[model samples]
Target: MEKLVEQVWDYTKHAKFYSYRPNYAPKTIDMLITLVGGKNLKVADIGAGTGNLSIMLLERNCNVVSVEPNDAMREIGIERTKGQSIEWVRATGIDSTLENSYFDWVTFGSSFNVMDRNEALNEAHRLLKKGGYFSCMWNHRDLNDPMQKIAEDTIIEFVPKYTRGTRREDQRPIIEARKDLFDNIVYIEEDFYFHQSIENYINAWRSVKNPYWDLETKEGNELFEKISQKIIERLPKEFDIKYTTRCWSAKKYK
Candidate 1:
């Protein structure tokens, strides 16, 4: 478990590129907030990298505690969300060090896969009020889309066995396995389009933790360069990338 925490430091190099990543679908977020009771609720956003979801929650009037372990990511999150109703804590999801039974909700924004899921669930249970909710979500590129298919082909051309890892998996089964800690499980997904310049789109890939190779390695650098060049040749200056924001949420049992 400690090793997993240490692995999070790899994001230090990719921290700056996180902003180029897509935000959660607005309607999806609104539905989540509504399901979890509503605005001005207390939220503990675990693995809150660079304040993407945190900023969205803040915009909806939620008092957010952004728990992030990576120094580079957390620093950027703090700077981006400065002066807002937020508290920045340097902590991992499995052991947030937050008071027990205090928060209305605990959430992971594109970050649940890095931690031990069972431990993260336990930590969420510990931090939430009796009826508080726990949720984790990720924005997945819609690979079936024409433009996205080009990106997929580009990646496969470099790493033939590339896999998206656990982030793209169905999380319902994992959450349901912890029946003792939670109940009333729910899953939601909404498709949305993110518009960005080709350059920013390429930068977003820099933030991804590629399973095939480490970006620091010579091979990985070459692979990235190749993909970037291919993308530039194929894509327009600016375009929309279709994405599906998938979220799984459960109510903490009293």
Candidate 2:
């Protein structure tokens, strides 16, 4: 499974995947800024694939350390932020070589599930200053929404079985898993709404190398073909997919 994930991460260097990957919601970025009480705060974005969240932090005038494991993704991050003064490091959450109490905030956006949760949590604790914030953000599909349910169910049936089990849309497990690492744990959730056309939605999935790589078996491909047909036959040409962007912040006590 780990090898499979590594292969998928390597494939993310492709032009289509690098260019069309979905970004973190602007409102989610604003919430992170608000949680830290201001901008220009030193930040470390863990598992910072292609610098999606790092770019968001940089846009707010914050100095960002983008830690990513995949060389391809890290290069894209560096390329995109060439003149923006962002520090791009090829590192994962667990082995980030940063010293203790180094950053004001450590953020994980849509990349938490791919990490060793326990190691990553401890690393975040080790890197944050006293009273510093640790945040995890994800753009989750609202399973209760009819359109979201359709899209999600289709993807689930088509993708590799393990991918479905390994990742989840809910944030509770991650928050609960890391609760003991921080003294003052708090959660804040905000909806980042977007109207995604059917093509846009499909392309977004295709662009995520991990998920697409997992959908490679003959059975999986057949399932995906069915899904694509269903999407074209039933879903509106343009429709809305609601996302619940859940963010949890925990502060280290002095």
Candidate 3:
């Protein structure tokens, strides 16, 4: 599974995936800012894919260390954030090589599930000063929406082995399990909707390399064909998809 994820993302260019990916609601960004108390605080955005979260942080006047291991994604991130003074570092969550007890905040945006959670949390705790914050968030597809349920269910039936194609985990239980590492651990969630053309939506899934690669075989293509046809036939020309961005934060105590 891990290798499959690496395989998929390694080829992920900064085009449609970055362009069509869901945005973390502005209010959620504001909440993270509030949790950390303000802007211009030092931040390490681990797994900062294409610098989406870093861009948000920079807009709030935060100094960002955009750590991403994938060169393709990192390059696109750098390209996308051109003229903005973001410090882009090529590193993973467990091996950031950043200084300890220095950054005011550490964050993971839609990328925490990729890491060895315990190691990453420890690294996050180590890199933050006493009372500094560490936060992780994801823009999750809300399964409860009617249109979305059809969409999700269709994919599941078509791709029986389908998981989110990457690790789909809730960090709350892990956070609580390692309570000794931090203080005031808390979780926050909010729902927002975004609309995209059905084509763009289908293209987004096509960008998911693992399943798409597997489905590239004769047998798999048939399933994807069905999914595409269903989307075209059932969904509106442009329709809203509900997403929940769940962010969890804690302050390092020791």
The lDDT per prediction is 0.91, 0.72, 0.80
lDDT accuracy of residue 62 in candidate 1: 98
TM-scores for all candidates: the values are 0.96, 0.82, 0.88
The best candidate by TM-score is 1
* Predicted candidate 1 versus true structure: per-residue lDDT over 1-254, tens digit per residue: 35536474478888999988989999989999998995699999999989999999999999999999888999999999989999999889998989999999999999899988999999999999998999999999999988899989987887788888899999999988999999999899999988999999999989987667578889888878988999899999999789999999999988
The segments of candidate 1 whose C-alpha lies over 4 angstroms from its true place after superposition are: 1-9
lDDT of 2 by residue, 1-254 (tens): 23323443454534346445456678767876887876579899998877778888888998888888777777777888899867887667877878789899999987777766677788898999887888887766667877877766666766536254334556556657665667566666666556777777767665454555445467655666677777666678887667777777788765
Top candidate, metric lDDT: 1
Name the weakest run of 10 consecutive residues (lDDT summed) in model 2. 1-10
Residue 207, candidate 1: C-alpha displacement in angstroms: 0.8
lDDT of 2 at 4: 29
Task: Report the lDDT of model 1 for residue 21.
Answer: 91
Ranking of models by lDDT: 1, 3, 2
Ranking by TM-score: 1, 3, 2
The reply for model 3, stretches above 4 Å from the true place, is: 1-16, 165-168, 209-223
